[model samples]
Target: MYDYDQVTAFLGKWGPFQRLIFFLLSASIIPNGFNGLSAVFLAGTPEHRCRVPASANLSSEWLNNSIPLEERDGRQVLSRCRRYRLEALAHFSATNLEPGRDVNLSQVEQEKCLDGWEYSREPYLSTIVSEWDLVCDNDWKSPLTTSLFFVGVLFGSFISGQLSDKFGRKNVLFLTMGIQTGFGFLQIFSTSWEMFSILFLIVGMGQISNYVAAFVLGTEILGKSIRIVYCTLGVCIFYAFGYMLLPLCAYFIREWRMLLLALTVPGLLYIPLWWFIPESPRWLLAQGRVQEAEDIIRKAAEKNHVTAPDVIFDPIKVQDLNSQEQQTYSILDLVRTRNIRSITIMCVILWMVISIGYFGLSLDTPNLHGNVYINCFLSAVIEVPAYTISWLLLQYLPRRYSMAAVLFLGGCVLLFIQLVPTYLSVVSITLMMIGKFGITSSFSMVYVYTAELYPTVVRNMGVGASSMASRFGSILSPYFVYLGAYDRFLPYILMGSLTVLTGILTLFLPESYGAPLPDTIEQMLRVKGIKYRSASKSQRRLKYGEENSVILKNTSL
Candidate 1:
């Protein structure tokens, strides 16, 4: 019986139908990119000091003296959270009016800011921090806000996968797009941090759920030759494109609310695309709706301008699928088998480490030396070449080596950042970007490698499990960058050390480059001792014994 790829081959690759699907699906990803990192600009904290109240009755001459100066980084700056007692300062001024006298300034008592704080507005006109007065005692709220968004993401990832399988992919995709856009709009009008956090959680759920819907739809429908490009260049590059657009948006629209409103406008454009894209035919076939699946395939053929045979989907293949015993697998199954269990544990660790390092560096872009706008933009810009380099490596290098080498290189660069002289911050920034490039490549490669490593029965679950581990990493990422408050190099040291160790762990996984996708866990175990190479048509037919199932090339997840 002919398979889905065979049906796709008959329709022709790169046709009008395929182009529409790719364009619309890819366009949907751009808004997710903007919302995912909007926290960088929205929660920015600027230089600030205690606000001296009018009741202090201080003249311009006494204004500077109202707030006590403390040593910070070997230089004196006004204390951010404290001010001198007004009565003591007034008495000191009245008693010792002479300049340069031994007034014993240390005797002045300090107190917490009674009035609100004054913020420097040059970098940001306003942010969540400045607007809500989330400073000093409330400073912990900023990172917690970012982490809470990812906590929303964590829950979203868990339920979205199962929901997509039950509901149609197209329906869920559209639903998530609406959820993301609607909640994003609500974030602009939030009156309190609590209100914004709840809205942000809903938006987070929509963010990952939307991505999963698009990813699965693209992987299942596109032709085999074009599937890799769709997953890598089609989906990922557009995400980077949206990322590159983020700093530009934030640069011009300096106000946090307006910037969020601006970022969310693009998602509204995607609502119309619902009419242009089709539901996944593979999903229809899996549900035993062969006639509906065939109808869509025929529609694709018509749009591709190819003539399709009257008999499109083979009945025998559908019957075989229906007749096959339904087997159930769970997360425990991943750890139940000995060999699969080992691979699963390693993958989970690898994903978690990669995510923490990737996101830690991404969120820390604002802290890097230079203009925050330029630094954030450069952080996004570096991914362009990194993706290009990754594309080249996927063609020539083994998956295990390429993944490990990039991780190790990125880790080494991060470790070296600690040694750069503090004055040479530009040098340090450059090294961090280099490390980001390496981690970016590893991040891109891991999705494909993990998909290839797992069998068909548990492929979605395996990828989902690893992705869930990644959410935990993302939840912790803000805190990792938060470590900079204690010491500038702490974030880098932790990220680098974890990356280096995980890089070594990656070497033990079997190489998937040029390998056939295993259909079962037993087949995957046998692959360890096997040498995989590209095969001719005759060899593929002989290998799979062409009674029905086809030996197709592996596609990226």
Candidate 2:
């Protein structure tokens, strides 16, 4: 049977139809750039201390002393979670002698904040922490909120592939887009943290789901040559566009609710894209809807002002499409062979560590000493070059070496951050941004490299498991950022160490650049780079009707 690409060769690779799909689908990814990182501003913890009550009956001088001083990062500052017992201080004021010199000020009792906190309005006028009072004993809740969203991302990553496969990519793409846009809008009116968290989870589910759909849709529709560019520069650069826009929006919109609102409204304009972007013909043909697939190609040919073959799909019998259905493989198949198992495990570790550095560094921006807005914007802006460099590395360098190099670079830079003086914030911020750049570049490389590492039969499932692992990394990342509260260098030290470890692990995996991708586990054994381990029972191939029973799972799930 003729392949789908051969049948549709008349439409050409870079025609008007492909360009439209490329831009519109890439355009859809813009919202994810900001939405994914919105928590940096939305959940920001501003400088705050215990609020003093007017009834304390203290003058301005005594009022300034209401808050007890505590040591933080080796500096004396007003305590955030505790204060001098205001009534005790009021009573002490009655004595003629000053408390510190005449009486022992240490004798004054310190207590947990009974009154609310007073947060500095700079940077963010209102954040979720300020609005909901998620500080002191409740301070842990702030990072938990970010973790819950990633929990939603985990669920979404696991299921979106299955949903997209069963229902078709276009359907899942638009459906998730609706879920993301609708839930994001609803979050604006949340009266309590519970309500907001529930909605944000749904938004997270939608956010990654739509991104997966658009990514799959574009890659499937465009020709093999353009797919690389779309994946590297096209998709990544546009996402950077949205990321660069995030700080700009946050800078202008000081309120958390308004920042969310600004980030979500752009999704509405993408509604019209449903009409413009056609269902992928490759997906249609796989579904055994030959005529629908041909019709789409016909329309694409018209858009490109070219002629398609009169019977482009006739060579592909409807029955041949069922072959993909017969070759079902599950996640277990990943470890069924030595070469594939090693690849899968390595990919998972690399993906998880990349996510740890990616999100950990991103969320830690607010804690960086320089201007938070500039720090975040520069973080986003650096991705353009990182992605471009990743594309170059993909074209010119060995996949394993490139992946390891970026990981090592990012890890080393982060590891060095602890050595910089805290007062040299410019130096510290520069190191952090450099770490972000290396990780960001590694992030793109892993996506492409993982796709190349797996055989076509179990590619999507392999990537899905890896992506699920990534959510674990993301969920833990906020806590890594939370480590800043305990010691500023802890998050960097941990993420950097893990990243460097993964880089060393990448060296053991077979390189994929300039090599034919394995189509089956049998095919992988013959590939040049894989150094086979001692064969075991699991690696033995079954030689019976049971082999035929293993159905091939769909790709890019």
Candidate 3:
């Protein structure tokens, strides 16, 4: 078994570079956060000031004359007054009067004393309605765009995975980062909603590549024992930065466009990734590029000032390489095996439920309180504790139990919000926020868990499919809000039930705690019964050299 000390040493030596990769990866996806929340600023009612004609009489007689006496109470008084005022004023023709001539008394007075009601309303309502031509215009189009973007992400993931497999993870990362940065900036300059949606899709496509490449590279570079910890921690810190930066962006740039521009600016900084990040040696060897792999190994050895030994990189001979196959896996391969199919179904369902509930709740931040900024900040603030707890729980609890408990707790909290009275809605929202934290934490855990379940060759594909499914949930979430589900917390009820069910379902998956990463489906199936092949005695001695000399000396003695 791999020891924690060895993993820590490896991370200590290479952790900075690993952190850098994750940072860039996280920055590239910040636009997702923007897209996720931009509706609050973009689609809300705008404040407008309009004046009513002054000559119009809004007195008791007008109300009494226009409306039946029985209907002339407080509720109908305003409507009756407006109707009579408009009717009485219609006979006068002010436009026909000569220039400088005295206008009619009704026209002059009505113009002077404006009494009409004016309130803020959504500005782009007509345009949005005409564009989609839907019954309601509750920003469903934005999530539609989001959904398309995720579809693009599915394609991008596959393409980027192939490119990373063929060329290298680092180069793909740099290229994808550059593309994401460019398109993300272009989103700021988008003139129309269509243009913005299109650009968002493009940005999402490229963003997926950055995430897939960085994750694969990080996992490949790390030692086996701590891979899950590093991957999870990397994402946790990324979200921590996201929560910190998103609020700052919201504060500095009140306009949604300006905020998006600010988010895009950081992506440009990742361009230097071309020079700093290195290709994964494991990938090179998997592709039969032994010379290239050895060269990379030599550079890493040089950087650490460790000597390299000559060895033939044969897949069949090396225990680590034994599972390497030349064939590339496709989406269909995910469902080809019963076990992979089960994992895929479970992951997809979990992803969909988490995303729908998590994002639906987060997006309701504007409706939760008067001060959207404060509410959004508070919501993000809660995530910090959730992540901290997740880190601790993941270390101690079985993966299934941890995932289940969080999901169930989150669901219960969401359900509890519904029974509370409107006066206590804030308390309910706070509970919902805590639930959001739990769901978000569970969402992050799914990534690590899924990665652990799938082999290296098909890992990205499996994750990519889950990403696509989650986006589908995002697409459907807007409709939940559109249907006034958020108004009475019905969405929360549905999401909560689904989450609890997902938690129960998680109990069935085989525990991967302390297990070696299975490099093939066959290996994954035989995890308990079949012992993993180990490196030969001579090979181990040759690889370790003087570092293991003490152990060898002790054994000999």
Off by over 4 Å in 3: 1-139, 287-299, 302-343, 451-464, 514-557
Global lDDT of each model? 0.86, 0.87, 0.64
Query: Which TM-score value belongs to model 1?
Result: 0.91
Question: How big is the positional error of residue 530 in model 2, measured in Å on the Cα after superposition?
Answer: 10
Per-residue CA lDDT of model 3 for 368-400, tens digit only, reads: 644666677777777677777778777777787
Which candidate leads the pack in lDDT? 2
Worst 10 residues of 1 by lDDT: 548-557
Per-residue lDDT for 84 in model 2? Answer: 88
lDDT of 2 by residue, 1-557 (tens): 55666667788889888999999999989998998889999999999999988888876766777787888987999999998888788876766446667657677888888989899999889999999999999999999999999998988987887888889999999999989989999999999998999998999999899989999999889998898999898888989999899999999999999888998888899888889988877777777887898888889999999987778776347556556455789889999977777878777888888998999998888998868899999999999999999999999999889988998999999999999987888988888888999999999988888888888889878888888888999998999999899998999999999999999988887778888988987776333456657556655555333554544322323
TM-score against truth, every candidate: 0.91, 0.93, 0.70
Over 1-557, each residue of candidate 1 has an lDDT whose tens digit, in order, gives 44678765888888999898988888888887888888999999888988987776665556667778887644688888888877776666566553225455567688887788999996899999999988888889899999888998998898887888999899999999899999999999999988988898889999999988998899888888788888887888888888889999999998999999998888878877877788898888888888888889888888988898988877778779767885888878788766688888899999999999988998999888789999888888888788877877887899999999999999999999989986898999999999999999999889999999998889878998899899999999999998887778889999999999999988888888898988788777432433545679898887768533343322321
Q: What C-alpha root-mean-square deviation, in Å, does candidate 2 show against the real structure?
A: 5.5
- Residue pairs in clash, model 2: 161-557, 327-551, 327-552, 328-551, 328-552, 329-551
* lDDT assessment of candidate 3: 0.64
The order of the candidates by TM-score, greatest first, is 2, 1, 3
